[model samples]
Target: MAKLIVENGGPLYGEVQISGAKNAVLPLMAATLLTEEKCVIDGVPDLADVKVMKGMLENFGATVVDDGNGLLEITASQIRTVNGDRKLVTEMRASTVAMGPLLARCGKVVMPLPGGCAIGKRPIDLHLKGFRALGATVIEDDENEQVIVTAGPKGLVGDAIYLDFPSVGATENILMASTMAAGTTIIENAAKEPEIVDLANQLNKMGAKIKGAGTDTIRVTGVERMGGSIHSVIPDRIETGTFMLAAAITRGEILVKNALPGHVRPIIAKLKECGVEVETVDDGIYVNARDKELIATNIKTLPYPGFPTDIQSPFMAFLTTVKGKSEVKETVFENRFMHVNELNRMGADITIENRIAYIPGGKTLHGAKVRATDLRAGAAMVLAGLAAEGKTEVSEIYHIERGYEKFVEKFTGLGALLTRVDED
Candidate 1:
């Protein structure tokens, strides 16, 4: 196991280059099954999640060549299998994305339930429902935790589908399947995340008709086949948000490069409300927060174009040092307050009931032994520690490293006294 030994109370100031979106890259890798030609993806983050997705695709008989310089060249032109290895599929939630492409291309697939951060529950019912609506049959083997889908003979036929919620995974599944279906498919209440838009752009490059991806309603016209092309994944906005929050918590200035400023409009606004100085340039975001007094701000987690749920934990970490009381409402997930207890261990005063969390700021915090309960929660701990009084030992750092590339390096570059160690 790895632990982060963080000596707190030091101001962090520097520039960080944001990586590709993990949320975008995973599904984009899965979308490769829509074509049999070569696809080269740029801005792909060197993350564990991306590695797992590569393993899943390799299991399906695709040739994956990581160019050793942050570029992945994948070709499924002669894919020899539709089913992925059960063990590999169960390790990453994004593996479920393979279902759409596999079924759309080979007509059948056998895969295990995907796994990832232990933050909340993910129901694949919507994913299965959309597949069924597109004329695919989904069967689950609970004993083995496998989802078996078969689409063939007559081929998939597109139809109008309505999702109860704007599930990102379900939206991706439908978008990929509809590309090869017989008729036009309209998906209502679809997810409007930048990742969804990135997937749509990639599919469009491969000859798929998809419109209005970053909106509530999406339209997809099924085509016979997709041709391969090269597309670059967008920079990871969540990573940018996390780093930007880190800079704020430490009362430091940081310029995060390669991140689109528009992608983080809501977060930038929230930070500005909290008295953090933000400047947007052509290629990056510069955060300046030399003032020690941080104003408390209320935040509510929502879908894309709004405050994202993925960055809530890290945002909460920033709120810990603000003056006065702050309120946070989580609408996306029920059990998202798992990080509250860990923060409390470090001398934070926080209360949670139902979907709302009340945080009273302006407390001096000292380091304590803390554990990470989820991916983003792990990031929250790192931010909290960077501003704490003394040494903070953050356990379960593997979770943080899984999502953030060179997290410690990023902090060290900013003159923070942080180190990674293999201590129990």
Candidate 2:
């Protein structure tokens, strides 16, 4: 086990470059399975989940090479099977993304139920519903926890389908599978995230006709085959948000490079409401929280163009030091408030009622031992540690390392005195 030992309440001041979107890279890696040629992907973040996905692709016969500087060159030209290693697939939730490419290339795919952070129950019913609409026979073996799918009539004939919600994973899965289908497919209520648009751009470059990607409705025209090419993923908005909150919590100044200010508009608006100064330049965002007392603000986690659920926990940490009261309602997942208990350990005045958390701010927090319940929650703890008055020991630092790149180094660069200690 690993623990983060933080000396609290240090002003963060530096310029940090953001990495590529973790969410974007996972789906893009799955896209490599669409063709048998070499596909080079740039701006890939080094994370545990990425490593798991790479291992999964390698096990399924794809040759992968990483340049260690956010670039990956993958070739799936000689795939041996559509079935992925059950153990590897079960280790990461994004493993389910391979369903589309495998089904498109091999006409059959067998993968175990994917695994990820223990935030909430992320159902795959929407993904299955979309595949079934594309003429695929889906079978679920709950006894062994596997989803085995085989091609249906004419090998995945595309059709119109509607989603109850704009699920990001479902949208990407359907888009990839429909590329090789016989006809055009229209998806309504699709997720409009930048990552989805990145996927559409990559697919279109590979000869897939996808329009209206950054909107709720998307259209994909099937092609007989897809060819490979080089693609670059956009910067991670979630990582940008975390750093934005880091600046606010410590009353510091930070210039986050390569962050798309438009992608984080909702968060930016809320930050302005909380008395943080924000400025958007050509390729970076400058945040200054000096001499500002953060005010309480309410947040509701929705899909893209709205506040992201992944950043909610870190926002909660910011609220811990603010003056007045705030309410956070999480609509995306039922159990997303897992971080509340951990935050409370750090002397946070937070109360959870179902999915709603009411926080009264202006509390002088003295850090204590805390455990990270999930990935984002782990980040929340780090933020809280930076603003606390005393030492903070956060366990399960792996969750934090899984998403953020060189987290300790970034915080340290921003004047945070923290150490990653190996615990016995």
Candidate 3:
């Protein structure tokens, strides 16, 4: 197993180039199944999740060529099967996104339920619901934990579908599936994430009629087939927010390059409230907080255009060092507070009542052995380690590698003292 060893480093100060959005690029790779022609995706991060998605695509006979840097040219000229890989499905949650593209391209798909970080319970009922609305028969094998979806005899016909919640995965899956359906499909209460808009743009370039992305209601008019197109993914807002927290936690300065200021408005607003100086430049966001007296602020996690839940853990780590009392309510995931105990192990005073984390700030945290409970939780541990007093060891770092690209290099560039080591 691999573990991260972190030591108390003084304030990090430097510019770090942000990687591509892991959340956006995964679905775009799945979208490659829509066309037989080659499609090129630029700005893709080299992540474990990306590699899993790449392996899944290749599992279905798609020719994927990664340019080592950040370019992936995929050609799905022939789909060998409609059956999703059971092993791949359990490795990453985004593997389920392949269901929509495979079903749309082949009219049949059998996939196991996806599994990612165990932060909370995320169900794929919405994805199946959207597919069923599009004239597909969905059968769930609870015994084997698999889902089988097959289009009707005449293929999929578009229909109006409403989601109970604006699930990003469901929205992308349904959007990709609807692109090649027979008629118009209206999805109400769809996800308004930038990744959804990115996928919509790529789908449009491939002759898909999609409008109202980045909104609650999306309309998709089906086409006979989708062609290939080249598209660049947007910068990772969650990653940008994480790096911003890094600057705040260590009282350092960082200019996060390739960050879209608009995508991280909530994070910037919250950071500013904590007495961190943030400036959005023409191409990047600069954060500086040396010797600043930080205050505690209440935070609530919500959907997009609101405070992102993905950054809740790491931001809470920052709050541990601030003065006064701070409260964080996580309305997104039930078990996201799993990191609270790990943070407490680091000598921080934190309590959870009714699932809300209450932190009394100004508590000195000494470095201690911790674990990366999940993807974002793993990052929170690293951030806390940077601000702690001694050496902190974080185990189960594979969770961090799934999302963050060049994790050690980026932090090292920003003057953080951390290294990856093997634990036997």
Question: Whose lDDT is greatest here?
Answer: 3
Q: What's the lDDT for all of these models?
A: 0.88, 0.90, 0.94
C-alpha-based local distance difference test score of model 2: 0.90
Candidate 2 per-residue C-alpha lDDT over 232-270 given as tens digits, one digit per residue, 9 for 90 to 100:
999999999999999998889999999999899998999
Backbone clashes in model 2, listed as residue pairs:
none
Q: Write the per-residue lDDT of candidate 3 for residues 163-205, one digit (tens) a residue.
A: 9989999999999999999989999999998999999998999
TM-score of each: 0.98, 0.98, 0.99
RMSD of 2: 1.0
Residue 277, candidate 3: alpha-carbon lDDT: 98
Residue 32 accuracy (lDDT) in model 3: 94
Candidate 1: worst 10 consecutive residues by lDDT?
A: 83-92
**Which lDDT tens digits does candidate 1 get at residues 86-114?**
77776677788999888898888888888
Query: In model 3, what lDDT does residue 318 have?
Result: 96
Candidate 3: list runs displaced more than 4 Å.
none
